[model samples]
Structure formats: structure tokens, C-alpha cells
Target chain A: MQQIDASAIDAVGIPRLLLMEHAGLAVVRAVHHLVPDPSAPLVICCGTGWNGGDGLAAARHLHERGHPLRVAVTGPLDRLREEPAAYARILRGLGVAPVECLTAEALGPLDEWLAECRLVIDALLGIGARGAVREPAASMIERINRSGKPVVAVDIPSGLDADTGRIQGVAVRATMTVTFGLAKRGCLLAEGPAHTGTLVVDPITIPRRLLETAAA
Target chain B: MSIHSSLRTPTGVTASLRNVLKRFERVRHLMTQGAWPEGRSVYGLPKIKQVKLKVRKAAAKEKEEAPAEAPATGAAPSSSSS
Candidate 1:
């Protein structure tokens, strides 16, 4: 899947930023489909990777459209990679400061946000995540599960093994999973369907040719 | 393997190798049973006992249990007579 995404970006000449934007838009669309009222509060939990960047982009879109939003990031802003950092900067410029919760102690406010919000966007982990889930993200997943708020997992649920459909230590039980490009194999594998509810596959504008070539 | 570890799904397929229920499954089961009500925290869910029912197979061997007065219908010819 990474190879296909790379080919789409590098060979097909689609800008990486465009992919992020499209993915973010797709998530927002799913959110609207679930909860049409724009004023409903929602929170996006993000990791410090492209997945987080997608969350930031979604935050921007949601904020622009006047949806009550809170964005929490797992790590410091400086540690964010280039693309995510760029989105982070844009978000900050829009006065949407993302809460950085690096430690379990810092997650207190996250609990309040989870309790207050109507939906959760789990951008904390993507298809690249493997093995047992570690701190902060693990804690966030637990909180999300306990909150009982319907969650819309970005790409795939955090802590879910995208290839094996196995739960790595713990995984978020999302009410709906809005996956981009294609449906990940893990979403259909063992214990995958139980955790992944109402799976929605949205194209992120990866060329059909690239997808076909990868499948072939 | 313990009976719990070899639990089967509704279709009679083995559910998983582990006897313990996944947290998600446990929580969902609790909710369905009304043990975990909505608005309650999901932490510290009560333990669910895995019930192992003793399935007794019905008495078998109709051929061996055939009545003494039964006709030898469709029975193979005796090789001793040949």
C-alpha cells in the first residue's frame, strides 16, 4: 500500500499535500454523514506522522465549516514530520492550537474533551503501525473506548495490525472507519470486523491505474 | 487444551486459541447483558465466566442395537455360507 501511495505521489506526480487534503476531506465527509449538525462537538486525536497531518487537515476543514472541534496530538509540535508540521502551522495560524499530550498525566484534559465531544477521529495511528501499542496512544485508545462516543477511525483504527487484523495489545472500537485509497486487509482479517464497524472506503485520488497495477 | 481455550463460534468453528475474551468483546458482551450500562466507564469490567457445557452424545450404533427379531434387510450375504 505504501508502494502504491509512493508511486501515486512520486511517479504519477500527485502532490503529497493533495493526498492529505483529499484524505482529510474524505474524513470530514464521513463525519457529516454520521452527524449532520455542524455545531456538534468533535475531537481528533492525532499521532506525529502523516496520519496526524491528515487530522490537522480535517481540523482545518471542520473549523472552517464551523464545527465545534478540539485537536489533540500525541507528541510535541516540533517532532512532527514536514507535511504534518506544515498542517500544524496552518492550524496554529488559524488559532486552533493543538493540545500536545505526551504523557499519561497530560491526558486529563483529553478525558474531558472525549466526554464533551460527540465523535472521535482516531488519527493517532495508521496502516504503518505494528506490534503492541505503546503509551499515550494506547491510553487515548482506552479513553476513547471508555467514552462510548462513536469514533471514526482514520485510515484504520489505532493499534490495529493493518496486515493481520490482530489487535496489538489494545485497539479502538470505532463505530465507523473511513479508510482512504483502499480498504486495508487488516479491517477484514481476524477480529478486524468486530473492531471495525461500518467500514467506508473513500478514494484519495490515487490514480485508478496505480491501484490496478498494485492489485495486479 | 482446556475447554475454554477450545471454545467454538456459533458455526462450530474454533473462536481463537486464547481462552480470555478480548477487552472489546468483553465490554460489548457486558453491554448486551446490561452489566455495563451506557454512560458508565468501561474500565474495570466484571469478569465473565466462560461456561463449558458437558455435551453428551446420544446413544449410538443402530447396527449393534438392532432388535433380535429384526429382519436382515439389505444385509450382505454371509461369506461362511458361500
Candidate 2:
């Protein structure tokens, strides 16, 4: 079987947060396609990296479309470094209040909120965090699944290693995963295909030439 | 058509339309013998229409004269009253 590694696209530097914006847009469109006139609520789980940025962007689009939305972040808002922070700020501007899940205690209420939602967007981790899941995020992933609403993985399932598509013990069972930039290797191989559900590729604005060279 | 009762015809038509469409989809799926049948996944390599054949075989084998055996002991419904 042919296998591609996450390292192949490691150096493919997209503009600061452009990739995240596109990821958010793709998710919003896909959700609309599945439930055109949605009647239930929407819950988006955000992390502290570019993946979180993707969720924040998705929240904005979903809110504008008149879908009831709830945004939850795995860690503290203050700890969100750079791009994700900016994306959070944008969501704030769009009138979305971010709920932080910092401890196990928070999981119950988050689970309750998730239960009321029709769809859950799993942006807790990106392809970059390709190893064992750590801390609150792992528990958050468990709770998201237990809610039983359909999950849409942001880039890859949280706690899932993008390199080998290995689940580092903890992982999100997404019903559909919208991959960013050239379809990550893990999205096609190992247990990745099963855990990811349906794979939808969204190549965020990396120039074709640059993608070819960097991938080469 | 007037909103009083004439419009009810369209409503009835649409309800029947929905039923027809649903039945058509089920029949289409049953005929295809695709990846999933009756909401259950059909694992492994595609084979000939074995499921339908199996059902037919079981039905044919179960055709023992049990009903005749039951009525033979004078338990048949009395038709003299009719």
C-alpha cells in the first residue's frame, strides 16, 4: 500500500492564518450541504493552535448562516498563542462567546451543551500534534463522542498522529474529517480512514508551484 | 384550486408521492444488492445474489404440511353453520 508522511507537507508555509480561514469555510459549506436547513444547534470544539483558528472561523460562518452555534475551547483563552488567538478575537467580534474547558469538571456542562447541538466540529488538534493526546483535550474528545452528535474533524482527529495515522491512545471518532492541504498521508492510511469517517480534502491557498517543490 | 377542499388533492398527492418515492428507493436498493442491505453492511468481496436465494431456500424448506396436520384432528372450523 502507498503511504505518504506528514513531513512531506511540513515546510509548506501558507500565509499566517489563510489556511485556517479556508478550512473554516470548507467545513461550513460541507455542513450546509448535509443539513441545508438545519433545525438543531451547532457545537464547535476549538484547541489552542491553527486547528482552533479553523474552528473560530467556522463559528463565524455558521453564526452568519443563522445556525445556533456554541464554541468551546479545550484550554485557556489566554494560552492560545498567536494565530488562534487572533481567530478567537474575530469570533468574539462576531458575538460568539468562547467557553473554556480547562478541567474534567467542565466536561459535564460541555457535554450537556454538545448534546443540545445537532453537529459538533472537532478542531481540538491539527495534523501538527501527531502524538499521544495530552491533558484536557483528551477528555474533551471523549465527551464530544459520548454526546453522540456527528463529529467533523478539523484537520485530523485530535490525539491522532498525522505521520502514521496512529491513535496515541486517545482520538476523536469523527463522522467526517475535512483535511487541509493536499490530503495528509494519515487521512488515507492505517486506522485513519476508519476514525476519520468520510475524508474531504481542502487545500488552503498554497501556490501549486510551492506545494510541488516543498512536497518534492 | 380553492383553498377550501380543492387544495387537499395536492396535499394527498404529495403524501402519496413521498410514499412512492420511499418505496422506489427501497426497491432500487434491494435490486442493487449493494454494499449495504437492510441497513446492514455487506462485508467482503461482492458475490452473486446469495441473500435473496437463501431466503427463498429457507421458505421452500419450511413448507411442511403443518396446517393440514393441525386440522386433521377434527379441529377444523365448522362450516355447517354457514
Best by TM-score: 1
Clashes of 1: 0
- Candidate 1 residue lDDT tens string, A49-123: 888889898999999988888999999999998888888999899998898999878899988998899999999
lDDT, candidate 2, A109-178, per-residue tens: 7867886888899998887785578778888888887888888888788878776667887889988888
Could you tell me which residue pairs clash in candidate 1?
Answer: none
Q: Which TM-score value belongs to model 2? A: 0.66
TM-score of 1: 0.72
